[model samples]
Target chain A: MREYIYMDNAATTPVKDEVLEEMMPFFKEKYGNPSSIYSLGQTSKVAVEKAREQVAKSIAAKKEEIYFTAGGSESDNWAIKGIAYKNKKKGNHIITSKIEHHAVLHTCEYLEKDGFEVTYLNVDKDGIVDLEELKNSIKDTTILITIMTANNEIGTIEPIKEIGEIAKSKGIIFHTDAVQAMGNIKIDVNDMNIDLLSMSAHKVYGPKGIGALYVRKGIKLDSLITGGGQERNKRAGTENVPAIVGMGKAIELAYENLEEHNNKLISLRDNLIKKIEDSIDEIKLNGHRTKRLPGNVNFSFKYIEGESLLLSLDMVGIAGSSGSACTSGSLDPSHVLLGIGLDHEIAHGSLRLSLGDFNNEEEINYVVEELKKIVQKLRMMSPLYDKLEGEK
Target chain B: MYSKTVMEHFTNPRNVGEIENADGIGEVGNVKCGDIMRMYLKIEDNTIKDVKFKTFGCGSAIASSSMATELIKGKTIDEAMNLTNKAVADALDGLPPIKMHCSVLAEQAIKAALLDYSKKNNIHIEGLEDINFDDDLHDHDIEE
Candidate 1:
């Protein structure tokens, strides 16, 4: 069988073997509920507590501030809806950006239907939301300003510290969906003045279906999913012990090796950029060159379709994603790409190859070589390329 | 993963090039959704002797265009016009569930080319309904 190259790390990463090994005993040997009063249950409960403490330490946040949920979407929904509902009397106004993951955008849309006003901030060509625009959009009635720390598609890192400062000055709660940024980037919640932060374990080489929200002390919000008195009654559900344990281990490993992993990713990312640019023309880079995530690289070929390029790469055993993984089937160019001022042709022709823990120089080189050939072959068959070539 | 036939058609597409100074040209798709196909047909004596295409889109888009041309070349105009998107997908061993629309677009581009040919020759084609193209939304992306 041919070896396959898994390069779509931004979509999700495979859990570390060490993390998986640590989580296995919880799934089988200790299946008792954490809510139970028996000693077996107590064992599960203590394991959960240890996991929570480890999760908190990884992000430089306090143990009491972290609340485990399902994933990034839940964290986003809870953060947006919880704040909007709790502060309804304070103001019905909310603020976010156009290029955010649909988790945040759709949640904001839901709030809009419930009589809450929301301002969708626009980003520049580099997918960076204008600080001035975000500031001006804020009104006295604004209750929260939620922006994603790093865009999933283009990998542009937003000005979170400045945005947090602006929201703090206006006495508005600031929440950032740090799902993609959590493991790859260092986020100091206290230093950044972030009121609330969203994260997912899957994106950090952990288990899927496990994530948390960093709700700063003294923040009051109603729970969306109510059943038991778990998570301090802020979020109520039976804990996913195995996933949570795996998540905690993943977070610990990520922090312990953060600098090394980030440096390697950035090196691979920069090399991929240089390779593509050196061989191809009329290609535009999608995100902020320096402020973006170390592992993410998105680019738009002027006349070739992203799907075509992706499929071509797939044939060569190089797996990658075009646009966002969630919205690939919709036949619409990515809103993230469009929001960054890419034209329809370029936007639809975008490719995002995000690297992670297992990727090495050999895999990067092979993928880049295959990509060059695919782009060249596809461009030759492109009517748009023919027109552009004629003009030139 | 696609079937073997699909991969074959994708890698070594049958009708790969464009026909220059042909009897007619028909193009489908807009750049907005990132697919643009231009099919050039050389119809001689009421038979499609050569069918060629240039496509700018995804895997399904290229494979469908290839299948469409392979399915129609040397077939009579009537038989070619009767070809549907489902047949094109079958010819390429079936497109992915999400990308079946690319085959649909391929079938439309072929019919569109025939329509253009019929208009030029004053030979009324079967599916030529009252058609009005704005030339604004499509012309900028798809060219023949």
Candidate 2:
């Protein structure tokens, strides 16, 4: 048997047993079109509405406000473009942070081609968006402000409540891509003043290809997909019933076990961070210390390449990511690292290890030991390290 | 995404470290591109007596340099100069499509060392004239 340890939960997670069990019935026995009026169809419709209520209660949202979509990317696209096209007369301006996911950034870029002005606010060295810069950047013509609750690369948690308050005072619609933050932490849409929120099921140990967008009551937006008037005609398509059912069950379980899970993850994360710091030299930690996610630990070694390190770890049956999984294969380093004031070389040396409920102490120790050896070996072959040490 | 040979070379590299007071030295790539290779050579009687390299790059790049040095260690200056990036990549099974530039760096580093060797000994090597060492960075930039 191969002994493997997976530490890339932020990229995606394995579906839990409960979620899989909940989805099994919907796939085979209860498989029916939720839009149809037949008895078999009504059973699926009831299950879908019950899942909607479960999703809403998890986030303290009203059931009517939750709209399903494909995943985080789609939710982001619909929320941004929907608001942009529907409220073009009210304003042609948008405000977002530089460290947003490409889903949000690329959507804003697409909107810019149609005469919409966008202001990308810069983040601090720790990847926190500057509330002052955000407040100053807003104008009378600014119709939307979209920022992420937690960054996917460095795992920095933003001041979303404060940002939501600012946007609320100005009456501009506020949206947050909570794909990384949804089940890991407590979020109340009413308390956060969030007009629109995006979330994905895969990040929270549910099925992929399904997510939700929480649009505040009475909010108006143009539709992205048009079909048989599903999702109250706001998003039109056959409902992804099994995935939705899985998401609801997964989210319910995530919150139920959140306190115990967070405690376990925080201890494991800190142990990994401390062991690496103590064993390695000339390394810098990325992201905020206490303000980061419970399972996120990122670091950059001075005289090592991340890809080589990742390969070495993989050979030992340990899996980790060099950066955000989306941008890993590109020769260019992560933009999120560059946005946080790291130079190109340091950015190229970044490694992110995200834990999950399945991880244990033994796995964490094994990972740290393997990482120490890999960094040492890579630095031995590094010409820059050789030059720097020779000068000494 | 590397072949077994590439992984073997990367895991247990052939010739690593620097040659002190070496006859010639060559360095290629830059910090911005996240790849840099510094090669050292000790030549005797028109033959490469010893070769060593230190590289900072991805897995393929380190493997390429290791393979390139192995290919030129016992060969004459003329034979070493004939070494191409494809030859080095082929010796290692093959590199990924995106990582072929690593092989290019290996070829450039060898040429750079040979150029330095010719400059010090005042030898009129045939192909050394066309390779402008100062502008070699343009090759990596343009090829991509």
Candidate 3:
């Protein structure tokens, strides 16, 4: 069997062995409901609190402020809908960026159907939302401003601190979908002035189906899933004990080696970029060169389609994405790519390679070499390339 | 999603180069819409002796072109004209619903080549006259 190089970490990561080990006893040996009043249940309840503290410390958030949920989508829905409905009298308008994950975009679209207005802030060519445009779009009736900390496709880090300050000074609620940025970047809720944030365990080398929504103190809202008054009656569901334990351990490990992991990822990412650029022609780099995530390298090769390139890479055991993994099967090019002012052809030709902890220099070098060959072969077969030659 | 046959054609495509000074040539789709296919044909006494294709698109588009070329290589002009997108898709075991358009490119490219053949020979080919080469060929069935 060929060795697989998994470079689509922005989509999801493999669960750490240590995190899985920590979660093992919870499944069989410590199978008890946290809602139960027995001593067995107390063990589960204490485990839940400990995981909450672990999650809290990772983001510099208080344990009381964190509410466990299913994952990023739920956190996004709850944060947007909860705030919108709760403050409907105050304002019916919400602000978000065009490059946000569909978790936030679709939720905002749903809100638009029910008389709530939403303004989709556009990003610059580098995928950075204009702070001046954001300020001008904000109206007295704007109740919430939910921008992402970093983009999933191009990996452009948004100006979250400035956006947070703008919302805070205006006394409007601020929320961030930090699902992609959580493990890759350092985030302090207090320093960033973020009112609410969303994060998922699966993106941080933890198990799926476990995530948290950070709701700052004294900010009350309607509950999304009303049940047995769990999660302080804010979110109600039976806790996923094993997954939660895995998340806690995973995040604890992620932050412990954050700097070292980032350094390695940045080096691999930059080396990949330099090698590819040096070897290939008619290729344009997507996203901001310096402001992008350490692990991200997105590029658009002329005269080729991304899906074809992705399939070619897959044959060589390299896993990557054209844009967002969620929207890959769709015929339309990524909205995020288009939002950054790329033409439809350029957008369709885009590729995103996101690295993680397991990637090394050897794999990066192999990928760059394989990619050069694929691009050359595909270009030869491309009608557009023929046209370019004919024009020349 | 692609079938086994589609993957086979995509991996080792047949008739993938251009025929030099071909009798007729047809190109359809565009880079702007993400799939561009150029078809070359060599017709001898109403029979397609040679057919080749060059495509810039997804895996399905390349596979469709390869399969389409193989289907029409030895067929008469009339028989090649009867070829449909459905037949191309069926030959590939079947493509995903969204990727059904790639097969359409195959059908269109063949029709386009026949149209070019008719124009160059000045012989009015039936059914080839109706093909509108200017229309946007990429009609994606995107749900709102």
What are the C-alpha RMSDs, in order, of all predicted structures? 3.3, 1.9, 2.0
Determine which window of 10 residues in candidate 1 chain A has minimal summed lDDT: A323-332
Tens-digit per-residue lDDT, A1-392, candidate 3: 56999999998999989999999999998889999999888898899999999999998999999999999999999999999999999999999999999999999999999999999999999999999999999898999999999999899999899999999999999999999998889999989999999999999899999899999998877899998877888888889999988988888899999999899989899999999899999999999998888899999998888888988899999999995211366656899999999888888888899999999999988999999999988888888888789899
lDDT of 1 by residue, A1-392 (tens): 45888889999999899999999999899988999999989889988988899889976789999999999999999999999999999999999999999999999999999999999999999999999998899888999999999999899999899998998899899999999998888889988999999999999889999999999998888788998899988899999999989988999889899999999999999998888888888899999999999999898888888877777887788888887321376656888988988777888888899999889889878877788888889888999888878899
* Candidate 3 RMSD computed on C-alpha atoms after optimal superposition onto the true structure: 2.0
Query: Clashing pairs in model 2?
Result: none
Top lDDT hit: 3
* TM-score of every candidate: 0.95, 0.96, 0.97
Interface RMSD for model 3 amounts to 3.2
Is candidate 1 or 3 superior in DockQ? 3
* Candidate 1 TM-score, C-alpha based: 0.95
Reference-based lDDT, residue B24, model 1: 81
Residue runs of model 2 more than 4 Å from their true location after superposition = A324-327, B132-144
Q: Candidate 1 or 2, higher TM-score?
A: 2
Model 3 chain A: worst 10 consecutive residues (lDDT sum): A323-332
lDDT of 2 by residue, A1-392 (tens): 35899999999999999899999999889999999899889888988898889889888999999999999999999999999999999999999989999999999999999999999999999999999999999899999999999998888999999999999999999999999998888899899999999999999989999999999998899899987789998898899999999988888888888899899999999999999999999998999988999999999988777888888888899888875211265656788888999887888788999999999999988888888888988999998898789899
What lDDT tens digits, residue by residue, belong to model 2 across residues B59-122?
8889999999999999998999999888998999988767777888898898888888888888
User: Docking category for candidate 2?
Assistant: medium
lDDT of 2 at A259: 95
